[model samples]
Target: MIKKITTDDLRKMQNKEGLILQGCGGDLQEWQDGINELLANENILLDGSKFENCLSFECNGITCLLFPFEENVKLDTGKLAIWRLRSHSTFGGTWLSDYVPNRLGGYLAEQQKPDCPLIGQDGNIFNLMGIASKTLRRNGMADQATEMCERITQTAGSYYEALNIIGEYVNITSAEDADIDEDQGMVM
Candidate 1:
């Protein structure tokens, strides 16, 4: 079950029990063998425990492995450090519990609140969408802008629905207002 995931997806995860081996560069097979050897030496490798059972993803150009454990397990930090040094990688394995977010704080922190001026603009849905998409692009969220436009075009049922869809990606505001307080009844 070697699944691939983005760092954003990883950040949103909670209560995940696993061993993460990071900073694996170059030969992935060598890293896998090294990890297996380390685990076997530590008596952590069970009959089903293998490199194939780990989730694989790349973070910042380095490969990472997540060996998900159904039961609580512990690895020797001293030996893990030695393995990391032997592998010549700057980073090493850690309990996934250390990275798992216990609350919604991480997700909230990552949320983007790009503002769009929809007030007193052409009430036409396309025009409003263009404004919101441009705002998203200006905020360096061009992917989000594209996704929002696609979602609106495919799913919006009416003008109000289109406005609601636009609102999901950006804060609707007045073009004349430069410093509108978000706390002061700004439409979401």
Candidate 2:
């Protein structure tokens, strides 16, 4: 299916092999049809490629398309290039492999460290996630809390990985630290 994805979603993807058509403005449907027609004329459609095998997105106010190939398939870029140049906005095409997505770094830099009381709690991954989610929501970062939990559930493979994901969104305090803070509060 031609899924609509965001720039962040695109950045997170790995090993994507496709053609990216950018700078498509005005009627998106017309552009989609034109691409399908071009693919048909070039015998790409005869090779079992379909319109549903593409993805649509918007970058910098221009509509874009991603024609994903499951395996290594060479396409005649000459026709696509000419077709793009004839568009109203002068669309451009690029090999998906040319764009390198940063798997980490840029995303982690934006994370907030809300304090989460995880040390004294059950070591169950779900339990720790709950504590962290509540703490994040209390800190007015409910969206981030949800995203963090989703990442853990979707991508984390083991208990330690879940903890790592949780740590990305919150500061986990040890039981000893909590006790020390309480004791210091009483003395103060």
* Highest TM-score against the true fold, candidate: 2
* Model 1, span 1-188: residue lDDT tens: 35666555566455455667776677666666777776777655655355455667776687787766654345554665466456545457665666544321243136667777778888888888898888888888786789789879998888888888888889887865633555566533
Candidate 1: RMSD over Cα atoms?
8.2
Model 1 lDDT on a 0 to 1 scale:
0.68
TM value for model 2: 0.46
Model 2 per-residue lDDT tens digits across residues 58-101: 76676778777655444555665555456525456665555433
| Deviating ranges (above 4 Å) for candidate 2 | 71-89, 100-188
Estimated TM-score for each candidate:
0.44, 0.46
> Candidate 2, 162: how far from true, in Å?
19
